[model samples]
Target: MSSGSGVQPKVGFIGLGIMGQHMAGHTLAAGHELHVYNRTRSKAKTLVERGAVLHDNPGAVAAASDIVITMVGYPADVEAVYFEAGGILDKARPGSVLIDMTTSSPALAERIAEAASERGVTALDAPVSGGDVGAREAKLAIMVGGDGMAFEQASPVLRTMGANIAHMGAAGAGQHTKMANQIAIASTMLAVAESITYARRAGLDPDVVLDVIGTGAASSFLLNGLGRKMIREDFAPGFFVHHFVKDMTIALEEAARMGLDLPGLELARSLYDRLVSDGFGEEGTQALYRVYNAIHA
Candidate 1:
């Protein structure tokens, strides 16, 4: 329903992880009927306490709501939630909307859209960027792909969770856009790590260096935000290293499918793979700085 329609759609949210929780929180705060489910029930505790209805499963949430949004972890998880028995596609009523906010395979997004259409349901692949901070502030950049009308209907709900939201094109376009975003981020993260490492190696204050160069030719969101995090050595999970690796893998796989050779992306993936192998997968991606730091030390 459009914001001006005076129709409040019942909203369901699945996957209450680092970003999902805040997004779902924003949806609830906007006064819609909010239903939620997560594998780890405890993660839904605060939201439930805040008047959200916590269901036993994804299907239950789907059956109960008018519009369902899933911000699950992996493509596999997205598959299970939508394609499994008693899943969203199985239980959602005809004419309802399904939005998968997970960063997943473009092919899978297209598959979900086709399956939903067959059942008279509208599906959109609307993956997001902006990490935990963006979600918390309701300032995420959402890239959506699906029917134009469906995007219009979902805009009001999407607005609660993001500041910059766009309907990219048909099914899979949103995911393709996200892959491009990840590819850019993959290499930028490496540069951010290396730049800070070099600054420190030369005995220059990284914060001052940041202040000087942050607005110059080398400026970027990752360089300014994650760069500072790297300088402070705060490796918390704003966006987990493992998750970034997963995005990079998906981008690399897509590139190969399209006959592209992205060497910079490949190099970044290798470094992040090492971080995961070294048991730092749970840390934020800024922890890449530690790898450079250790090498310089």
Candidate 2:
């Protein structure tokens, strides 16, 4: 609860995948006594070498830390980590905090909050954006939803991993906000890919076009960041294509629940689905360019 100098919380981090690895590292570097768990122990090697305590399971991590955070892959993974036998909710001490940073279901976030409350633990759905680079640089934008008091209690620890952090509302609000984020990004991704494809077909240097258009109203994080990655053919998973598809699916489902229609998001999802079908799921979202190329071919 203390945010002052030299105060370090006992923090437990589960999921050491792409962005999680760097986020955990930032927490450890900020002086927290870090406990970590990953399904693949090999992924935690660098953090363990830097003095983090590695645990065999989520429950172990929760048992050992004052605050426990999970940044896993899917809604099912989220449910398993929090509700399975020997899970975090089963082992986390009373009054401890649980933060799920996965872009997951709003319903699931509400479920976790209710379960955590029943057991005297505080829960926050604190999904993040800014991809692998942001995680590595500790500049992620963290959107949090839960009790206001819990958000305040976790602020300093969250600060270690993000530059832009906001408490959206209660329980499921964070996930809803994240769904909104994904919806907006969905259309922009297609646009960015199409724009680059257009520039390339016109025989204008795409990089030069990026320099001009990226400074105009056409600019975006996708344009300035992932655009370069696309231009360089860097299809590595800063944020994977499959993952973005999952996010868009969640957004579409959520929108449907509210009796809304989003044609652009639907189109983006269809293109990403094609990418997945063609074996580019593990590639970065910048692989949207491949879809454009395939279409124009």
Candidate 3:
């Protein structure tokens, strides 16, 4: 739909995981007609109680929505949701907007955009950052890529879910931007874990050290937030470890395609690989602290 159409879009959301549930809630709370679906119907129950229409599958959600947002797990899951039989593209209205907010492959985003265009649907790869806290607080950073006009039409709804929203460029640009985000975060996560571990090993109070360093040159959201989580040994999934590993792999693949090598990113990916191999895939990225914690313990 065009910007300034003065119509509230029917919003459909898929993947009601840790982040998506809160995002859909914000949209509903903002007065959109909300439709939703998830593999586990129980996840949609809370939204359904709050006036969202529950659909059984992706295609049904698309049919009922003027704009559809997806926040599924892996690239393969993204493909299955959009390309498999009875998918979003199959049922989306001609002018409906399709947004994939999952952190995924740039190539996959490009493919979805192209396929959506073929169906007269506008698709944006609008991946997000800020984890569960940001999702819950409506403070996410949304990087969007696709049609500029479509981005404008989608911005009001996006603002319900994010404070920092930008139109990066054409198709797949958002995912590329997110890859850059993940690359920077990968090394920082490693450093945050190492720093806190070092503090404990040196017999310093890690929390006080965090208070000191977190205000100085070394401060960041990861340092302040996830570092605190680390100190408490809270390994819950704000952003899952397996998902971070997937993001790192996608970033490294993109880097390899450009004939570039990133040693830090590679090293971080390897450590996360260990976490996944050790069956901590469902845990938060901060669980990396456990590796360091165990070594020093």
Candidate 4:
């Protein structure tokens, strides 16, 4: 995806939320002409002021760029942007490639791939891990589900926003891989929060236990990052509790459909549902600490 001569890639970015804001900025900063769109117009204002062009709708952004990148929150939203009446496919050129960077359903990914292929447009499901911090620092791990040529075409733009760019088989594979990631992390996050809470209850300094435990076999990004936040009571959302809850919901559906029993993932999903039901849905997932707080308080 390297540039040839002075002609840099013309990039399109939609979904200007927290992660999207930082991501689109990277493309603009990388000297690509970024055409941008967002549901709420004000979210795109800052980037437009910085010389990124704003489109009134998704179709407008697609019509203007060679590559269209989407990172909206939900599967329906992702579909609506790409295939809705007046969506990107309606206006994009035949050869333009679409990369869905949203962590969404494998079914939806395949659906988009089929639809795009019919129109001579290539599409990939390239969901990502590494929360807001990863996006800001360009250190995200991107799992792409598409063919080699499309991956090659989209790599430069993906590289501007992520560090680990892996091509996971065919279309829908990236999202399947991402669901596996979320499922693995789900219970681990609960354990991380529960362990720290147990330590605090026993009058042991959490920092001391975190220092010791994080050095042992139990260490993870969830442990290190969430542990630090629990210590400081900084429950701000790098990844919201609501979003992880949504991811778990998707994984659970996938599991049930395949006749697989995911007990651990279910437990974590229950924990998040409790968190959301307890009115902590808007808080960062590290606020899983509040669960133990309810019992220990």
Candidate 5:
């Protein structure tokens, strides 16, 4: 199917989680025919109501579209949607483009790309950042890796959902970029938590400390956002602790495969493991502040 530019790309979106919904919405808003699928059909109802066509299965979604984008939870889920009995790849056309937007492992991304290539489908490992807020606001940061032509073909659609977009390299580069994103986020969260805890124990107003330091060289997403959450004792999940921990494990695994060590990332992973062991796995990544709370308590 042709898009508005005479090459109307009929797009299929799988995964209707915190991010996928908004990403898919952009396609529909851009005058593209969008077919959406989700394991939970109920989530797709709203999109359907908004004029997006909802398919009952992955295959149906794939069959109806030219470009298929997936933003499932993890590597396993990616495989399930693309390689399972009724996976999208089985129905997607020979020249169709498949982009995996999940922040999965580079190894898994590479394997999927290779699989897609064998069947004559172009695949891109395009993991995203900017969090849930970014998705909702159509301001995500996207890192893409795959065939250059495929990236170019997907960029306009991608740009609709992201504020920053980069072509990292060949297949799996986006996931590798995301691993670095996760590592930095994981490490920063731990450091910010520790800093706020020390500030509070020193009898300083944590908010004021954040206000002052958040403007200095010490500022970061964690320092500004999580710092406020820490002072208020809010454990609400911005990004879940469970997901961050899993990302850390993938990073360390990749590091080992490359015969290296990511000490800072390893340290953050340990802290998250401890948080999970204490039954905080379901809490927000900001809940890492609880670890420092316990230390001061």
Candidate 6:
């Protein structure tokens, strides 16, 4: 339904985690009738109070809505919520749209698309980046994969959550694009961590170093945002290390399938694995700085 047509579509949102919660809020604020479900009932309290319908499960949400969007964690969660016996696919109306915003396997995205098609539903894999801050600010970058027509139909809804939304080919392309994004972030994270460590070891104030370098060619979102967080030791989960590790694993597996070797991604995965082993898995991706600190110490 067009946002400008004065017909706000009924929107279903599953997964009320850090980013998803804010995303659903934006959708609600945009005048859509939002139906929300999360594993944790308490997480949906505010949304429910604000007029969002609370559903018992993903299926219930899908059954009651025109567009179902999932931003859950993990491929397994995506699979369970969309393909299980009582999942979205079973309950969503024939003409309803399904958007999986979770960063998941391209294969799974393709599978979901195929299954949705057989059921007369339109499915799109539209994974997002920009972290919790982006979600909260409604400025995420959404990379979508599916029919161009479906993308157009979903753009108004997607716009409420993201500033940059692009249709990148069909079925699984968004996920493939997300994998590339994770690969680049993997190496850049290491660089950001090491640069901070290097500055501190040389007795230069790391924050000052960041200020200078942040204005130059070396500047980047990671360098300015996560970089400052690293310096401040703010390890809160804008994007969890556990989640980043999962993305890295997916990228590495995809690379292996294509006969590609990505040492940077491999190294990042290994380092994040180390953090997970050390009980820092729940921390933010910026916690990779802890690895450098521990090694240096």
lDDT of 2 by residue, 52-163 (tens): 9999899999999888999999999999999999999999988889999999999999999999999999999999999998999999999999999999889889999999
For model 5, how does the per-residue alpha-carbon lDDT over 1-297 read when each residue is reduced to its tens digit? Answer: 244358779899999887788889888888888999888989888889889998888888988888999988878898899898768778887788899998888877888888888988889999888877788888899999989988888887898899999999998899888888998898888788889889988999989989899999998877887779888888876567888888888889888998988899989999999999999887888888888777322
- The regions of model 5 sitting more than 4 angstroms off are 4-7, 295-297
Worst 10 residues of 6 by lDDT: 1-10
Those runs of model 2 whose alpha carbons end farther than 4 Å from true positions after fitting are: 1-7, 295-297
Q: Give the alpha carbon lDDT tens digit for every residue of 212-297 in model 4.
A: 98988988888988888988888888888888888999999999999999999998888889989888888888888888787322
Which residue pairs collide in model 4, if any?
Answer: none
Off by over 4 Å in 4: 1-6, 295-297
Task: Report lDDT per candidate.
Answer: 0.93, 0.92, 0.94, 0.89, 0.85, 0.94
Worst 10 residues of 3 by lDDT: 288-297
The digit string of per-residue lDDT tens for model 1 on 1-297 reads 323467689999999999999999999999999999999999999999999999999999999888999999999999999999999999997789999999999999999999999999999999999999999999999999999998998998999999999999999999999999999898889889999988998999999999999999999889899999999988988999999999999999999999999999999989999988888999999989877876322
Error of 5 at 95 (Å): 1.5
Assess candidate 6 and give its TM-score to the true structure: 0.97
Best-to-worst order by lDDT is 3, 6, 1, 2, 4, 5
lDDT of 3 by residue, 1-297 (tens): 533477789899999999999999999999999999999999999999999999989999999999999999999999999998899999998899999999999999999999999999999999999999999999999999999989988999999999999999999999999999999999999999999988998999999999999999999999999999999999989999999999999999999999999999999999999888888889999999977766322
The count of backbone overlaps in candidate 1 is: 0
Judging by lDDT, tell me the better candidate of 4 and 5: 4
Model 4 backbone overlap count: 0
